[model samples]
Target: MLSNQSEVPSLGPIQREQAWDQLQKNEFDMVVIGGGVVGAGTALDAATRGLKVALVEARDYASGTSSRSSKMFHGGLRYLEQFEFGLVREALHERELSLTRLAPHLVKPLRFLFPITHHLWERPYIAAGIFLYDRMGGAKSVPAQKHYTRAGALRLAPGLKRDSLVGGIQYYDTVVDDARHTMTVARTAAHYGAVVRTSTQVVGFLREADRVSGVRVRDVEDGRTAEVRAQVVVNATGVWTDEIQALSRVRGRFRVRSSKGVHIVVPRDRIVSDAAIILRTEKSVLFVIPWGSHWIIGTTDTDWNLDLGHPAATKADIDYILGHVNTVLVTPLTHEDIEGVYAGLRPLLAGESDETSKLSREHAVARVAPGLVAIAGGKYTTYRVMGQDAVDLAVDDIATRVASSVTERVPLVGADGYFALVNQTVSLGEQYGLHSYRIRHLLDRYGSLIGDVLSFADGTPELLAPITDAPSYLQVEAVYAAAAEGALHLDDILARRTRIAIEYAHRGVNCAEQVAALVAPILGWDAATADREVANYCARVAAEIESQQQPDDEAADALRAAAPESRPELLEPVPVSTPVQT
Candidate 1:
């Protein structure tokens, strides 16, 4: 939070209306489309540099690939196999910077053990890569990698099969709540005077002769059209990059390919391991991440041409992950063990290779048209670099009189005074009549901004109580999601704001009605409207679960698309425009 924090710049109903009013009438130096990590980072970068900006998102922030990521802030160890040393080094530097300064509260160092089956040559080969990773990150990165024997590795990870490996290596990386981090970034941008609005979709580009000027955006919350004027427009949509480019009707400089990855969450007791594991599969790498009270086992990289918003995971995909991990686990996990499953798409830069895994994770910035700049293809670790690069190109096109990228010096919303807040957790817990552990959870999620969240439950003591079905989160979280955060739909609250969807066994269906009732009054929803929201969210969850049981991608996609959409206006028609061919 800032030194003179005023409720961390609330993004409630009042703020959204004001933002849209201003966006329709005023002209900004730059307007960024897509509220993912890169887009939010870009908005912050531009706002800090004294440029007037507006950030618009069709869905919630981090609703796409950002929220459904593997949640590791790594330098892509496997990239070294491709001999892309420059990319690895750049990502490593950014990873270290984020952990130390930019988002210290959100990103925390995590240890991962890499088991080696063949002792003689395999250790040396992996050791060389670890050495380069540490060297590339300077002294600011995570602790240097360590070599471990079979006995030491077994002590660290008792769940592993005895014959699975002869030795292991432990390395450090950072982990975070991806949705929370992205939302905080957007809030930070709003605090710095950038207009931020969600559920605003860009229908087409506003052009003056051959030069692009702004965008024609549709307000999904209310059926209305508005032209947001800006000197330069930046397209930062990740998986929707090519789709946004085609809207401009300009000759695209590059192409974007979507790759699907799925993760399944199970109980923490399912895998009795102290450290996370990185298993090398024949096709790619599989990560067993240690999430709170649960384990996240994931990620299959395959080409996906299905729905971008609702990427479905097939039965085969789940079977593949379970089968591979079972080879190394003493007690293998089954489909019944899964508490939640999520699928996301990666926007890789398309080129000669048809394989999505072979596509480049490195992003490119190009001036597709006169005043339009597009950025696509980058991993979560390197988003800040991508944001800086995107802004640099946009400013060049606009020729705006602004300072250089100072985002490297700007900390996120909760980064300021976070350590001091941690020290006062016990005092705060006593003041609120709650356990220190509960206060610690609030501090980690909200940092110094915990005051804003706690203040909402001050008069209403019942609001501080833990939810009935999902005890991990407090009831006040649901209220705060609507009263402060711009969560208009129940799905937004369950899936993104609090992460109850993936953390709970019922996948948020068990608590849907309760959450809807808690947030209804704040969002001005009547009994019937609240019931509709709950019903819609329940339908979505049921469809997703059924989709996961399907045999293949086609079957899964068909089943998932049959569910009711929370934001039906998103599927409504807009002022159509000609899309440039590939």
Candidate 2:
């Protein structure tokens, strides 16, 4: 048994073997494709149930739509309008589980203020809606909805226009670092003996007559290829579900349409609100979420048929969000206030309607072919339920009697002693010679894992210094990303492992060199490789910034697509030499 967090546990060489070895010996219960939230959860669900599972992703974990979501873990309040009680309840239960039992470190309760414009009718209508919302599944995890008059609401949100609301109702929901949560789920799956590998692409399906016997995987990092055989294969590829299904030569029961949602991040000082704000828009809902040190305002839902790899936010999208949000802001937010802009695609299941906004967020699972099960089209909140259902479908195909999913009761790796650690924040702060507020920040991000991070700082005093440009984050965290997390490239460190890419004014361009210099040794990168990585990351940032300036999605996608691919020198052998730290 692994005794310490630093001790790298053995998951068998085959789990990390080349594609040839995988093809040579392929005997598994299930092979799950995709490493998004749903896919990662599916792997954990299957593995915990005594199934020998292998999970593969073409890129980094949560590299697709999962990482680029609104990053909330709440029951869809809009779904209540659709009268989807079951979806809301299941999502709420999962949210509670995430916050209280599993991944408490990554998921925390966030309060939202729903502003009411009309005096009586709107107030009661919203109050009753929120009342039913509070009764859903995880209402007790946080404080119940509170009624506030216009004066009270204005006091809480001083940045709001006085006339925007007659009253307001504040309610609770969970928010998460969605990408990190997805990664932790994959790591948790690995901890439970699931063979999980990122940068591995599912090239094709291995068909034995009418049934899919296995998958042909290509190592996108290197140019190697292999085939992994399993009793069942599940497709949880999110937006890429249709492409995966086409490989098997089968018509899907349902199609997934991509809807692009864009968010703009501005400094918290710009919108002085203690709680997040939700307002109605002509097309859909607009949320001004309170992110750390910044507020995330967004989401324009429109059909996107452009590039799927990196959805670009057009000038029009930004203008729409800013225009709608500016309607209520006392100090209007313009393009200048935006520190970062991101666009993500939501895979909504196709319906008779052409309107992408009205498409179903509910997931669908179908046996496209014998031994092949595909799950697609779900909101991030209901990923666990989608995972459970996928695993249930795959279970029947297996010859052996598999155990039931125990994921509901299982706390994620960092969650076991989270509450106690949080309670001891004062003591921990004193122990580490840190302020209680800083300790609270660390605990919320890492939970008991904070101790392990602090241990590194205990020895290397230099690691405790905050990053040169981004003072909100410490330098040691970047080092930790290389040492602990499988951060292979500079993009992986800044973009996914940390929010420096979106959180910074320069979008991590200014801090890229320093971060690369610090992490180069840990990653065994030569000076040249380190420089290349930093350059690639800067180019990526430049591309995104340039893309957002375009007037339309088509033009924006072209501009963004022109950016250098993050994958540099794919065939370049892994270097053995390390860069000398300056």
Candidate 3:
């Protein structure tokens, strides 16, 4: 229950307690597990269609694979090589909807050059694929692809070595802050009256004979447990899909395999490219993307069988990426040039192919049990469609004729007045006594909710000052995260809300104390608790740094998993055995 001033119910500490109480006292039509993009999208779709829905997550929203993606919203270009046209077209349509209508403020069009190595057959082959890509179903907004000779390509990206390519083709895609977009979707669900809570783990399923009727959940913060009754339950967990399906004591229609993708961040000046570059790799493709003040070079796709919560990026992973990307760069990036490293797992639908890269990005939906529906294996771009599909199946269990999904016509919370606010950036800066540049940055992150974020600084203007160590972000951003964005731990603020962890060299260790102090009062943390939070965050950063130096996944997992858990009550998961299928 936030103050009456907010357009939606702000998911602060007050509202969290209310949601927990309501979960026990009332029965919902649907309860969605997992707070990743698809889970949040499902909740939003159900709520908008006039259903009482609840969403619960084991950790913070997007804490898993959703937060750690390559941060793009494009059709998988290489999938065209596999002749997956329907998947590509669906993704492109979703990308178009996001860019023009859904979240114009957060999603921005970006340019990328696909370098041509062999002179003869490469150009036409690549050109035809991109030609189909640009003219796909809903790609009316972005510019068409253009061919560039070797000299022209060098002019656009001078950092590329002359010997690497004979020519290139520059094309358009889109980029986003994945964590923020996912959080915004959750908030929009709350706006439409869905109950959403984080740091709440589903321990078991409640059953009526043969079907799931509800869930038993534990508050990770305090170790308290409650049972939530729902007519239908949706398992939207990405990597944890199988674990949850096991709890239902039912046979899942499909299995999910985790594929690890690693990315490294370096200073923007490390490459002198005006646009991003894409190169073909032996296994797949590598992207050198532009991310604000840094260039994000990534993605090694391999099988990972270690900790699903924290996917560790080993020294071998870093070396693999640098070796591939360095082939095209004028100055090869080394270990010292790296500022940040992150790894995420993709929950691909398991198939006969052993190669994780060869698995399909196409998602599947199944009515695993009478009252439980499971959806898994889709790219980030098509999350909304996956949600609609999941809910469409769950509606059969509800008995009532539910309204069709209205999420496509529904704008997210901050999207309405965003363009108007962009036009008023100068005036907003003058009124708030800040620079126009800073105002633009706030606008991009918070959109029309910028006023709600700055409202915390009404009497205390010093809160508007930049963070001492991470000067790129203001101090008030941290406060807003704790007060309104459902940030229960220091890692939630530093890693997801503001991205200071991945953008800075110290990886949020330097600013941990100051941030903890700022949110202490809002979260009702005493002096001892604040100090403990700071200590844990610093230790976590140290563990990650040490883990990255390891030679392989096994070594990295040992170091990273040994670090302290922000939610200490959440111990090792005990496997729940599935009953024999009827």
lDDT tens digits, residue span 237-319, model 2 = 88887777776666667788899999999999999899999999877899889899999888999998777778999899999
Best by TM-score: 3
Q: Candidate 1, which segments miss by more than 4 Å at Cα? A: 1-3, 138-141, 572-582
Choose 1 or 2, whichever is better by TM-score: 1
Candidate 3 root-mean-square deviation in Å? 1.6
Clashing pairs in 3: none
Global lDDT of each model? 0.88, 0.82, 0.91
The residue-by-residue lDDT of candidate 1 on 428-534, one tens digit each, is 89998889999888877877778888788988999999989999999998899898888889889999999899998899999999999999898889999999998
Which 10 consecutive positions of candidate 3 have the poorest summed lDDT?
1-10
RMSD to the hidden true structure, all candidates: 1.8, 6.3, 1.6
Question: How much is the lDDT of residue 527 in candidate 2?
Answer: 91
lDDT of predicted model 1: 0.88
Most lDDT-accurate candidate: 3
Using lDDT as the yardstick, the better of models 2 and 3 is 3
Which wins on lDDT, candidate 1 or candidate 2?
A: 1
Evaluation by lDDT, superior candidate among 1 and 3: 3
